[model samples]
Target: MNRYESMMNHLLVQFSNTKVLQAIFCAISDELQLLDDTFNNLKEKRWIDTGEGAQLDGIGEIVDRNRLINNAITINFFGFENQINTTGFNQARFREYSEPYLSSTSLSDEEYRLILWAKVNKNNSLCYMNDTIKSIQFIFKTDIAIVQDIYNAKFIVGIGRKLTKNEILFANALDLIVRPAGVSCQSMTHFDKDNVFGFYNQKFAKGFGQAPLSEIFSNNLIKKGYVV
Candidate 1:
């Protein structure tokens, strides 16, 4: 028998008058199953939301051995628009859902939260911000074990609101006012002379890609705030 069944059998033998407890355990199991179903549905829908940006219009495979290593919620689903190389992802950090990769990395709490909200939603095409990716990402792995949602919770400085499971994906590219509604959100794609200059002159004056994002100068302008 499985672990749960074995445990229940042991409990029954240990305590003769424990029918109520067994019933309660059974009910708890049912509730947990329901929660599992709901979580799966939500995750699938979210993955679908990334369809517009993913390289493949349809994702299908037989072996499906390769894992999409991503920390950026949007990048996880959509991939990159112009570069198309996988921005917003750290490979090493993707070890949980993905097979281990030496080059992959993880994100800071604030960074992860911001990227999550910026993702496209099935209900609303608009992106915002949130902390839902970790739990949603882990739904597939939690069938046999209870996966804990571990994340450093933080706020979007733009809205000063705590993030929930559903929200938008923030794009550093959103600051590029030149691009139209959709393309502008692809920060890894566009180039805004003014924004780039500003980011360079003030934030990373040492030259671009010199320092870690957290080490950069601007908190409000770069990470949290919504700029035009």
Candidate 2:
């Protein structure tokens, strides 16, 4: 999730009454727009397209370096950085152990622990979680464990946004799957049917719950009578 997405989701969790939350949502949305110049959700459109038949399937599509013409372009989103909450982290963790402590074998585990975290003023129906959500006037409770290396680690935790199309392209080009912390599947609604896209469908069976995002693309590109 982007910072704004996180904020919106957290807002949903915070308030029960829908009507009251709308005002707050609007205010935040307005403020975010004001910050768009410096910290934007999408890149600036500064390039003029060439009149030639330069073509790319999508805005972020990779072009053939040797192609006679290509219309590939890059977008940059100046997103906000995650703000670490040391106090909130401490409160969330079990205070009994000063250092990170978990009773597991030598085998390291990085399960659904990579799950995103959010703040709630009171305990509502959720999943495996931290201690409290009402203490801090500001700041959210996000997983910070993904970046840490703990002996006999039981879970993985991360706090970051999902990969954009351009980012996925860069990672796929290198044949390297960016980890959960760095990138995740884009939402299905954002995808075009035949474009190469990544998704995280939880179909776990083996000892691993951490499934890398999968890609789909070009399956129907050469249908019998399709455009040649």
Candidate 3:
């Protein structure tokens, strides 16, 4: 078996063996030393040799792994209530529910806007903005209607923002999926390279219309429309 499988099996044995548990408690300090040695040997040699090791590449990955491990350990070692009290830990509890929404390719213009708005707001609940409410109230707001075409169609979600150096670095590092409203090729030209416009223009023309960002946000475009 692999190191991971071995470790899991060892853990399961430790849990099931009352004699082993009693022995472990009696020799807790020595047991920890042995465990540490065993784990050290099991860890990837490359990770131990390299200074950087197998450290996660991004914060999101780190957070996600932490969530996974925390959940597993808690469920195995303690009961559900004993789960760590942390933002991402609690967030992980409902992760299955959030996964579909996070991975969703189909959403209406209003729904897309609401999702972006929720990200910007950094709130748990999806709520509509006054402007968004007004827009929905005035427009058809149908699932069939493309939001990008109906609206100003300037901003593109999931694009790197160029507002400031810190913002740029943060956006790049986080790989954020949200951008400012009304920010388009014309508006971004002053800061970004000309190629940015060309890339997005081609992307828009290929299947998406003038408002590529809006088209991407639209659930209909991704789910049923011709746009790939």
Candidate 4:
């Protein structure tokens, strides 16, 4: 067997080790049989690669495995065996579903979010900045002042708003905006003269900026605002 196949076999063993199937259904239960059928079907498909760098192939295999697991969970635990439907199976797939789409060279969500949030908030210079707040929150360590500064400066007004020194330091530490070495600025405006914001805007703005904040920032600020 190739490396991918070996990995799939390992995963299959891990799934069975959970013993979730046995716990959820009697040995001869129809649900158990369904689970067995799903598992054996996956094994028979020989879709998994037992080698390194087999992420793409593994995704399909892992997804099939999770599907079987979820089916077993839903039927035996949730007592939804009668409602065995495949309509929403996609959501239960593993995180590896996105592995193929990612690149080793790509900046992490944290890095991308920091860059986009800094640019949008700086360029628009608009209060009531409803978007990209979550990106800011996720990229930076959770600091209430930093969040409030970005929010109140652009979202809410007449609220006696200012970013604390610590918050400014934190934002600066992200280095989302490139600046000359040893230069210091408390706010984004200091870098505006050289179009520093524009520089970052051009580099990190595409794809990263456009991605859904929920995916990029771990919070759905837009949905929370009813922006849809």
Candidate 5:
């Protein structure tokens, strides 16, 4: 039963059937429901996944303090020398590569939440190689490869085609933001069989002259998305 019915049920026996008292209790019950809804909304504001609007922004303040935007921006006040423009001869047009970049404005509610959640996991949880793999799986729920090159002090993240533009940007920046400092990160498209160099007993292993040369810099970097 709703609040109105529950309130009427508890009344003293003599007052239970009174129409005047029943009307007053019904009005009070409606007001109490509005408070219940507002209270629940306040409770949801504590989490990034459930918060909306100002509540979401409040959560962002704690997790994403820097408010890093999905896309990187480069600005140049002066025009570049010797740049050709087919559309027009305007130097201003040639110098400006894209529209002025706005921070934290281009992303949607879900995209913003994704960024915040990733940072939240990174700040609160383990961040080793395996942890990074698990974090990617939990945050993205897609096929991603994390290749570690300890000798070179670098790791590469291979993102598949399922991510959004903002997601791709966040994935590219994940290393610098989440991983230990001094480790370089390179994010790129997923490596296909043709782009990966192979070794003996490997998924894409090839003989000396049996297959074409691959463009990947190292054999350890590619092997069907496994950590090597």
Candidate 6:
């Protein structure tokens, strides 16, 4: 029922529905409706999951104050545009690089919200190794493991399945951004069930070329993101 109808029902039995009272109730109902709408908007638009347009932009600014990031590059579903190879012509011809690539397409509100929340969660991290893993996990919504090589000052992130073109881009950029200073990171995917390349022997002295020395699959290792 509308506010006016509810107001009329609340009156005593002796009171009549006069024209003057109806006019006053109609005015009051209009004002109350506007107030109710404003409050309802606040309830729906306050969070990232339900926010849209200006509300999503406001949330982005809160986490990414510097505005160093662009939605086009991060959230674009299409591949990079205007790509130029600095090396020989073969570079990036049959292969792709995770370098700070650009995108020409626009990102939808939902896509923007997803990436924004991932960055926000990463920014709020405590810089611990587990936090780093968790941040990456939040992005892909999958289980992954990180191998830390403290001696070499590097780490290897392993995912079980293959990542799509767009996912590879996001994963590469995220790894570089969240990595610690002076440390390197690499993303590896499509691992075997055994987690090793070949079988072992009693002597453990297999020949150098006995098994596959390099990665078994293509696009298994995505290099770190390039700043330039």
Q: Cα deviation of 2 in candidate 6 (Å)?
A: 5.7
Residue-level lDDT of model 4, residues 1-228, one tens digit each, is: 433333335555557555565444334455555666677766664433222223323443443211111101111111122222212444344333233311122323333334444544434433232333433433343322122243322321111123332333333334333222343223331111212222244431224444322111101221121111
- Models, CA RMSD each: 17.6, 26.9, 20.7, 23.0, 8.0, 8.0
Model 2, span 1-228: residue lDDT tens = 444555567764547457656667666866775676444423443111311122212211222122111111122222222211123432443334343211111111111111101112222323223321111111212222122223342222222223344322222222111222323322111122223233445122122343333322211311111111
- Among all windows of 10 consecutive residues in model 6, the one with the lowest summed lDDT is 216-225
Model 1, 123-167: lDDT tens per residue?
Answer: 233323222222222221111211122233321111112222112
Judge candidate 2 against the unseen true structure and give its global Cα lDDT, from 0 to 1. 0.27
Positional deviation of residue 186's Cα in model 6 after best superposition, in angstroms: 3.2
lDDT of 6 at 151: 60
Q: What does candidate 2 score in Cα RMSD to the true structure?
A: 26.9
Error of 3 at 82 (Å): 48
The alpha-carbon lDDT assigned to residue 105 of candidate 6 equals 46
How many pairs collide in each candidate, listed in order? 19, 0, 2, 14, 0, 0
Error of 4 at 21 (Å): 37
Q: Write the per-residue lDDT of candidate 5 for residues 145-208, one digit (tens) a residue.
A: 5555545666665532244433433443343235655665643444445434458775544667
Q: What is candidate 4's CA lDDT for residue 71?
A: 9
| TM-score of every candidate | 0.17, 0.16, 0.18, 0.18, 0.63, 0.61
lDDT (tens digit, per residue) of candidate 6 on 41-91: 999887889888878778877887322333224322222432222234433
Q: Residue 210 in candidate 5 has what lDDT?
A: 66
**RMSD in Å for model 1:** 17.6
Backbone clashes in model 3 = 2
lDDT-best of 3 and 4: 4
lDDT (tens digit, per residue) of candidate 3 on 90-174: 3444434233211112333333333233333332323324333233222222222111312465432222222332222222222
